[model samples]
Target: MTSIEIRHNLFDNPEVSGTEYKTVELIIKKLQIYHPDILTSDIKDGHGVIAIFKGKKQGKNIAFRTDIDALPSGHRCGHDGHTAILLQFAEYIVSGNRPETGSIILIFQPEEETGNGAKKILQSKVLQNLHVDYIFGLHNLPGYHLGNILFKYGTFAAASTGFIAKLEGKQAHAAYPENGINPAKAVADFILALDSFKNDDISNFKQITVIHVNIGEIAFGTAAGDANVMLTLRSFTNKGMSELINNVTSELQQLANKYSLKVSYDFQDKFNALENDDVCVDIVKAAAKELNMTTESLPEPMRWSEDFADYCLKWHGGFFGIGSGENCKPLHNPEYNFPDELIDIGAKMFLKIAEQAMVD
Candidate 1:
């Protein structure tokens, strides 16, 4: 099947994070045509599929990774295109267009949107047994020119996590104003404290966004006894993020103590900062230049978090962006769709990178 066909199939059947069984099955089916040495044990869990293509001679193992799971909002982040690109590249390798030496490993990672997929895969024995030397991945950028390659050295993306604060207190009847301890004031004050945590300094790049809040049911007779505040905390560096989390935790603990309420907090969907290795960045640049694709250097790291950062933390890897189009909707937008034109460009880029990595 063509790249467009595969993309349409993936886009048509979208699965949210941690539940990509059908998606994985479809990818396995498409990959079967190539007849590569496929691994499905890790894929059985929430991990993902790993396809290995052995070369005629022994050499290093170069791996290219792509996310398989779609967002809750659907394929608005263009993961469908990302998966299609990798699949098309697999076809290229199977059709006698592979390296002369080393093997190639294609990783179709799942649950990237939830930020636990890479961590799970890394902990598994799959990648450890392969002994992968170099890793590479890319994302489609919607605001840049179509097919333009964008790269950034060092920190490429921010480290972020969801902070959920739960506050509990005794409920009181509405008629008896001061009968029970109310957590409403504490919740409001905590949110304001979070807002105060934001910094305008570009170097620090700290932000706290309130995503959700709940204070009880719709009953009018009883005062709210419990409250929840869901927030997203982000920073450019892991150190900075760690400091911020520490500060937030301490402050929340203090607030709970002051209000005499039981408060607990947990983090979810944590994404580490993406730091690109210089060698890997050079390889991507060389591939782009060889393909005559326009390249752009980003001035600053993106504020958003990506699960690929987990891989970069463990491996010598680089993550770049391919322009989707200047007019395309931003990622996660409800109306957003992955562009079909990117399939060939992305596939060619991956193939070139793999070939370059295979070179001595």
Candidate 2:
């Protein structure tokens, strides 16, 4: 099947993180046709697929990966296209321009949106048995010239985690509100205190975005005894993110104590900052140059999070971006659709990177 066909198939039947069964099944079916030397769909949770092609002569082993799960809703994020690109590159390896030395591993990784897939893959028996020398991956970036290559030497993305604070107190009739402790004031104070943690310094960037807040029910006769505040915290480096978490948690406990409210904290979807290997990054730039592709260097790391950070931390690799278009819709927008033209550019880019890595 063609790459565009594979992309459309994934788009028509999208799956979210932690529930990528159909996506895995379809990828396995297409990859079987390419006849990789070794193919696996049963590693760990069996929600992702791995295909391996070996060269006749022994050399370095390189791997390329793509996030396969779509967002929880709206079918945004361009993951379907990412999967198609890797699948197309796999097909090319079998049909033409086979690597003269070393091996190629195409990893269709699931649960990237939930920040669990890469860790799971790292622990999988399949990956543990194979030693990979160099690795690479990419994301589609909107608001740039279509097919342009965008990269950064150090970090490509930021570290981020979700925060949930639940407050509990005594409830009472609204008329006699003094009869019980109310948490409304505490919740308000907590949110305002969170603002003190926000900063945009390029050297030490940090951010706290409130995603949700809840304060009891709408019944006017009753005083709210419980409330919740949900936020996403980000930083340019892993150490900075840890500091942000520590400071916020300490202040949050103080607020709970001051208001005599029982508070609990829950953190979710933690992603480390993606720090690119300098050598791997240079290989990507060289590959793009070899292909005569337009390239742009990012002035700073992106404020977004990526689980691919997990792989880069475990091994040497770099993550780059493929421009979708200046007018393309922003990711996570309900109207967003991955530009189909990116399939060829991204797949060919991976091919060139594989060629460059075999000799590096």
Candidate 3:
């Protein structure tokens, strides 16, 4: 199958985060052609695929992972780019030319963009049974030159937690403000409250805090029976993240009560910060250098969250960002395409990483 066509098939489907059946099914089918050993299994109602390749000499079990899910708007955030690179790499590995040593586990996880797939996979017995010693993954970075790898020694990406706050109030004529509990004011107050709590300085702590509260749809003619605000909170450290989330929640409650509006909040922990192990970094860097690919350390923690953090928690693993070049549009942009040249390098990097980890 043409890689472009595969990209289209995956890109066209807006698998979203929690609901990623279409894309996962397609990836499973594609992998089956090369590796009949591939298995399509479900994790807590959602699907996650796994395939294993044993080496000539048994040393340790190593896993290379890739996410097989897209965003809500579909093609945004370069999911298609990631799929293309991963598929290319999968093809390369299935060609049966790997070095002799530890076994390889190829994990095509779902809902990565949602930050749930890694956690779901971790909960499963498959990963635990494999006893994977090292985990390696990569993502496409939009702001840099494509095909370049940015690796960090410590935490590379921030922890992202998002949720929606639903504010319920009495709806009445706009003419009488006191007669009706207008939620519009509550929404405004919530926005102000979140903005006031924004912390942009990284030097104060391990990483900066990012808080975004955007007002969703609101009916103006009506007094506003319902109003909602989508909140995105991010920070480098788990403790900082906890504190930030608590502050936002508490402030929201106060604002809602002040306006006499009944409020209920549901917080979904989307993703945790991606912290890299130094040992994994050294191995991957050496692999990149040997392949003649330039590598650099990340300057600051990526404010965005990645589901890969879930994998890093249990396994000695790391995830790096591959530059998509300055000319390339930013991630989640409608006009985004994965650079084809980077596919080979990514494959080579993982292969080397697996080899190095499994060596006796």
Best candidate (score: TM-score): 2
lDDT values, one for every candidate: 0.87, 0.90, 0.73
TM-score (all chains, Cα) for each model: 0.92, 0.93, 0.81
- Off-target runs (Cα >4 Å) in candidate 2 are 72-74
Evaluated at residue 44, the lDDT of candidate 1 is: 41
| Per-residue lDDT of candidate 2, residues 247-351 (tens digit) | 888888898899999989999999999999999999999999999999999889989999999988878988999998999998888888999999999989999
Best by lDDT: 2
Tell me the tens digit of each residue's lDDT in model 1 across 257-340: 998999899999889988898999999999999999999998888889898998887789989999989999999999999989
Over 1-360, each residue of candidate 3 has an lDDT whose tens digit, in order, gives: 666677777776767776767777777778777763436475765677777766677668777888777766666776665666667767776777554566677777777775678877777666665667888888888788768878988788888776678888887776775687767778876776666656777632333233444333355655656777777777876667788778778987898778887888776766777889899888878778877888878888887788788788888887887887888877777677666566666777776666666652
Q: How close to the true structure is residue 123 of candidate 3, measured as C-alpha lDDT? A: 74
Per-residue error (Å), model 3, residue 348: 1.3
- Sequence-dependent TM-score of model 1: 0.92
Whose TM-score is higher: candidate 2's or candidate 3's?
2
Q: Which residues of candidate 3, in runs, are more than 4 Å off?
A: 2-5, 8-22, 36-38, 56-58, 72-74, 94-101, 166-191, 203-227, 253-262
Clash pairs for candidate 3: 77-332, 144-325, 145-325, 146-325
lDDT of residue 126 for candidate 1: 62
CA displacement after TM-score superposition, residue 332 of candidate 1 (Å): 1.8
